[model samples]
Target: MDIFADFTQRINVAVQTVLTHYEAGDVDLSRVTVEPPRDESHGDLATNAAMVLAKPLGAKPRDLATRIAAKLARDPDVATAEVAGPGFINLRLHPGYWLKHLAGLLAEGSDYGRGAPTGRKVNVEYVSANPTGPMHVGHTRGAVVGDAIANLMAFSGDEVTKEYYINDAGEQVSVLARSVFLRYREALGEDIGEIPAGLYPGDYLVPVGQQLAERYGAALRGMDEAEWLPIVRDAAIDGMMAMIRDDLTKLGVNQDVFFSERTLHADNGGRIAEAIEDLRARGFVYQGTLPPPKGQLPEDWEDREQTLLRSTEVGDDVDRPLVKSDGRYTYFAADVAYFRDKYERGFNEMVYVLGADHGGYVKRLEAVARAVSQGAAHLDVVLCQLVKLFRDGEPVTMSKRAGNFVTLSDVVDEVGRDAVRFMMLFRKSDAPLDFDFKKVTEQSKDNPVFYVQYAHARCQSVFRQAEGAGLALPDFRALDAGALDALTDEGELALIRKLAAFPRLVQSAARAKEPHRVPFFLYDLAQGFHAQYNRGRDLTHLRFVNPDEASISLARLALVKGVATVIASGLALVGVDAPDEMR
Candidate 1:
């Protein structure tokens, strides 16, 4: 249960009662909010009710605050509701109020932080790296962020699909095919030295070429370019895709769908043409000339009439061209078809995780979503910023390996997956991140994953000590009704308040589509638990293992178990593990 939410409702009831007592008027409850005080010394919570409602009622904020505080003080749940600066109200909830709900944590266990159902089907498309090469560090960030968002939404009861768009139809893969063909020739005893420019030079292609040589020795070489292109391309794509999927598996990211861009080409059922025709029938497509692009114009820029989609009608800055003057569909045409395909799959919400370089695609994709879904689905684009590798405050050399980039597998193999996943989400998706290889593995408070896991480990350590003290592992959920009331200390109450905020926090994070908030919350929670544990060192009575007082120790044990449950749940959401021991 969300104890804070219940308190907010109570505060609303008191405000309603105050309005009736003053014979004033009804105020919008939605405008009111109950949140933690900026300074813990002030009180447990603060509200802006009086300040928000005074303007509507044509009264001074201080006067409104005084009247509302009087009514709130009468509430059974509120121990004190003091009026602060500018009609701000500070509230101290009754200790008993939090005490009762502490049992909700033990009862719910890891299920404590789950959010209510959103009743929306969401499709999260991410890390759709081309099948031309392995995933890089940039792709890793997108992969982790996207996977976290999908897991969060799934936990919130949204039917979510994790998807990857294979860009095998592009020029990049054509180069890959050529590169693999070179390797295949080399495997067939040809002197293929010095890879040509504009072709992939990654050594990873050696194996793909070897496979081609073993499968059809000298057969592909005799065939014409067009005849052998598809065969060689398909083999290379399959091999690269297998490697990419293995890298993702190492990072614990799983995709429900791997959509292929090749399927939208004219030779592959002409989905792009069908999409363009559908748009033309809707009166949204036309032959039009786009003005020379702003700033530096392309050397080949010309005012030619071509097939264009009215992207501006939705929200894009300009209408987008669907086809080139050569009668070939542009990349945006394939994208439009892909968007329409996702919409037809019954998803009411779409999320695209793109790299920072692809920021401009946001508007065009949004425009496509609006056109295809007819505004029935909401599209959110998360642009992941770059991650620079560092080592102990010095820049770490991430020399570009195969395909002109450091593969994601290299980073995961270097630092464990936990550090990679947690550090990837340690900052907002759009913010720049410096991932330090040395610092991430250090067992220090600055290492957020370690700190958070250590808190859970401490909780387990307490249970182990309890077992040695003649107390068995008891069913904490079935503890006495008064189990939590034994936790009346100020530190205990503060921890309870934080635990009680889990459900609300999960819901807020899901609503904002931000999974970075999970790590922030976990780190803050770990600090709280660590501080509480350290306090026991100075105060013997506060210790979790007290032979003199079995009941108090057991009640505190339940709270400790609650902490572990929440840590595990939050870690699961972020695709990290919550270990029972730091060792």
Candidate 2:
């Protein structure tokens, strides 16, 4: 069903035949590659077998190209083979091949671009926001990117685990507990003045404070820090986690596993401490003094011996600390234990989606996974850049301290979930994105979300128009390949070529671990659909509902339906809804 693969196989056979006839010194068949020409006018597919083998064979590329072309000329799949611009074999496929592609699309439908399963287990950890506050715009980008990547991998036939790592045991959570306690005191009518500089001042936590007062009453009012810290910390953590889960649900992201950082060290059982000890047993951990950090040294910096990981051996910038001077495990230590747990669970591939600010930390983390797994597991970290919010061409300022930060709920409320998901994925994850409130909502071709969705809606409109003309639409199962040959228009062929490339596109994007390519491919596919639609405006005969000719109308309808099927399948992968009607 893959015309490109079919043609490549044909060319490889031809090349081997030519080599055998010439008795050319052993040619490496594995070196043969077939690809589409960068310039479309060149051909449907091109190969450089002749050019690649020419120098070693002591022959001119042009002469070798002629021999290869003559051998390939006999292939039924190849309509014509000619050498163009310095020994490039330009190949034009038979019209029947393209027609077969349309039929294949109809046959496969939603499963057309699915790939063979690798059967390897992969764990993708993303949107592991600290359970201290509601998710903001920054976390939203990571959520969408991570979720789309997991979806893409799953579609590509890999077993994927979607996970969220909760930082509930960290110092940040302690700060959150104190902040909530201040809110609790405020709820009890205590005059806690001028919300301290580093404490959370958002009104969202007021409810958490009030709920604590209602539950505990005056029992916690006169208790020392030790007596009430745990009580308040647990409540605040639970409240924050609930708020975060709600924000994720609003954006259509649901985690398969919620991993608690505290669980690694629960019951003073010290599983994390045990993990570090195991690493030390493997020579990955040792007591060492680190070199002073470059650029700027902290005013309180002091030279001291601390437990460090042998990260430099695995390619980190420098050895990393595993314990702070206060004799507590560093954040990196907890991360190592968490990844070890992932390995124990039988995942050989792990992907971490982090904010752009964590770019400097990528090498050391990858090194840790490498050392801990002893090169058995592969870890890839995708750093998503910050999103700058704009409204009417001006920057949107958000300050959590000033209680002015825009929550994820606010954005979802302003624009529906479909627009939010599509726009977030319209750009590469590593590239800084500008989210314009006014522009995305506008109904215009300039808005890519609307444009792609409109293509889907237009396809449905064609079906409705065909019904109005009193013509029965062709069943995809009943469509004849020969009848599709009537769609010989240049634009129609161009769209079909794009459709034929979908499986290859999916494989390439999945192999590269880049889900952004899906949106880019969708945009190009939408452009093809739009161009074909606009073509009908000029030539009424090309329109889908030509009442005078049922046969021609049915063929065109089949083509548009193919376009709609692809749009729906692609949008579904990225978690965007494909609408049948756009108002």
C-alpha TM-scores of all predictions: 0.95, 0.94
Q: Which candidate achieves the best lDDT against the true structure?
A: 1
Regions of candidate 1 where Cα sits further than 4 Å from its true position:
21-28, 266-269, 299-301, 398-403
Candidate 2 lDDT, 285-308, residue by residue in tens: 999788898889865344888888
- Number of colliding residue pairs in model 2: 0
Q: What lDDT tens digits, residue by residue, belong to model 1 across residues 163-270? A: 999998877887889889999999999999899998888888899999999999999999998999989999999999999999999999989999988888847538
Model 1 TM-score? 0.95
TM-score of 2: 0.94
Model 2 CA lDDT for position 257:
98
> In model 1, which range of ten residues has the least summed lDDT?
396-405
